[model samples]
Target: MTALERIAEWVTSNPPVTAARRAAATDAFVDTLACMVAGASDVSTLGAIAVASHADPRESAMCVDGAMRAPSSAALINGTAAHALDLDDNFIGAATHASAVLVPALLAAARQAGADGAALLDSYLVGLQVQREIGREIAAKHYTAGWHATSTIGQIGGAAAVAHLLGLDATRIVAAMSVAVSTASGLKWQFGTPVKPVHAGFAARSSVEAALFAQAGVAGRSDVLEGERGFAALYGAPHADWPTAPIDTSVAHAIEQPGLFPKLYPCCGSTHLAIDAVLDLLREHSFAAADVAEIVVTVLRPNAANLPYTHPENPTQARFSMQYALISALESGTVSMADFEPATVRERRTHPLLDRISVRTWSEKAERIMLDQGRTPHRVELTLTNGRKLDRQREVARGAVSEPFAPWEKRRKFTSLSGLSDAHYDAALRLAASPNIDAIERLLAAAIRLRNGAGE
Candidate 1:
């Protein structure tokens, strides 16, 4: 029995308490929905994704704005839109966008399946737990070896959601898990490319296909996870060791740990500490980008490595560039959606400030490999020419698995993300406190209608 086997049995039995998972699901749900709405107007990128997906479509579920399409296509668009701004939540342990990767896909499938909000919410919890467990089992090992954990571990989440929705028998669920092992994919090298968003879309599409295959009595290798030639052997070597026997997962870790970090910024969580650190410094002093001389950031490996191209030629690449992001923060006093525009990144003023920024490992905690990152966590030190130097450090970034979101913080985040008016905000509170998706949707629709009629 693999971890999937155990999870399948537990979820099959417990079916998960809706009330328990509801609040968390609703929190993430509201955030994902907000991102989708905000992103809907992003005609260039998000619009492209939605248009590309329009080529082939099916009506399995209705998306956030209430459009119906094929399960796979719906998931792809929703996943891409939810993550377009890079503001969705992340999972440190898994090294990926936790909610962004899972919620959109499940929401589409469940809504199309006519699943009540309770079932949809419960399935999402199951997906979150399963994906995180897979991530812990692999750790940074596979990711360091070059796999993107969000796509790699996230497919399992897709599988979990699909299984719960279909009521797959344990055996079939185990087989679907096997399909996921083979399908696990995503590359960090593609961070700045359109393929980055494709990672989320592919995971969502694969899960739907994987589940459909299993439902059709297609059998996959049950031992694919721990098998000698399986996922562990092929992709996750050097990190492949779980306590469960080849056929025993009865004592698998309980599936009820809290979910991952809900993000505030629209970039990698790796960038958060630095962003927050820079903001911290500004709290004390108001300095224009031109006023600042050199801003130095010393941090961990990819935290440093994840920084986008020094000169981001495009919006997608801007997400990966620390130089650009930090510069935008210094100039704008915040990093907003507007900062990523082509004109913004190309501005001569912003470029000079970005050029003034330099990052180095400062103190070599370890030798610099081609990417010389030390074993110890990276610490950031920003120095300004005004003879001002500010220091900030985090062993674990705030939204990392080490530090999770507080309930109130999540609500505040959700409310802000939902773009709900005062009345809608209060109404959403009621809906979130005891979720009824249909009722919530109706309330949301009525609010919009009211707002529109007011102009008349």
Candidate 2:
């Protein structure tokens, strides 16, 4: 059988949903919801809302703003909003914004199907596992080749999740995945633009439509993933060994293993490690930003490539700029959302300190050695005016599984970003045991109302 078929079978076969897995899924939902709230007013989300609001058959799915849209359109708008700020969690195993796509797609499907919170969490774990399985084959090459894994890999896995939620059989699950494979597309060139988050919206919409189409008897090739002209061949992995082993979700789920990297800073995750490294140095030493002669950051080639902007002209580009991210952290002792505002970016762009930061990459041989050893390290070297050099290297950022945030830390982030109360955070925590997601939807609507009232 093809790899896609094997995945479909595993997806259709109900795996045991452990307590730990459910908690992880719930945590992901909370984070994605907070992101959706924070980014609701972003220009990218507005664009998605405009499109989704105009689609036919509206009122099928609830948006963050309490407005209703068609199911696919809701998925698009919600997904875009979830990722617009670039603060959503990252699953390194898949090299994608896993929850940003999964949560929006699953939420819409769950609401439409009247699925309870347990079902949503179950489907979330299932979809994340599928993404990990597929990402194992092509993530490194695909991401390096400049294809946005969040869209390409996300759609296939998201389709599986939506199919599971809608109670599709193995055969129809295969059909959904095949349809998703054909529609999945995104590029790294859109990194500094609003279209980057739209990639998540597009993936979410495709996942919904593909699964719904499969349920409606749309036929598709079952071998689309490993076929000669298929996903692996066309999207960076030419000769990838598809399906090396059966997916076993009986043990640890992907969310509990390599785990999701939740962002503390609202910028591209590529700059996160470097930011953490520099912060570590600053905390340990007595040097101020003005005391530094130069800042040198070293990361993997792909990360280096992701940060192409040295002097960002706007907030969007600032999110992808190593110079801006690092320097802002240095200047203010930490990077905050306020730093990325248009006026702040414009003011900081002319700072002489921006030119003092230089970014480099590890040699190809060193990168190969690190890759072979399963290490992704970002190093920061600070040269002071008195010739004192402080160096720090970070393999894991603050919010990664290796160094996770405490419960209070996570709650603090949620409240700070969404401008909601502790009751809302507790509501999200209780979702796993709730009868349905209706309460969560109401909380989200309240967040939208709050934000609108605050004129944010």
Tens digit of lDDT per residue, candidate 1, span 164-216? 77678778877777777778888888887776766776777677767777777
Whole-model alpha-carbon lDDT for candidate 1: 0.65
Off by over 4 Å in 1: 15-21, 41-58, 64-66, 111-113, 245-259, 285-288, 348-350, 360-378, 396-456
Write the residue-wise lDDT of candidate 2 on 59-149 in tens digits: 6778876787788988999999999999999998889999999999998888777798899999999889989989988898889999999
Q: Can you list the residue pairs that collide in candidate 2?
A: none
Worst 10 residues of 1 by lDDT: 247-256
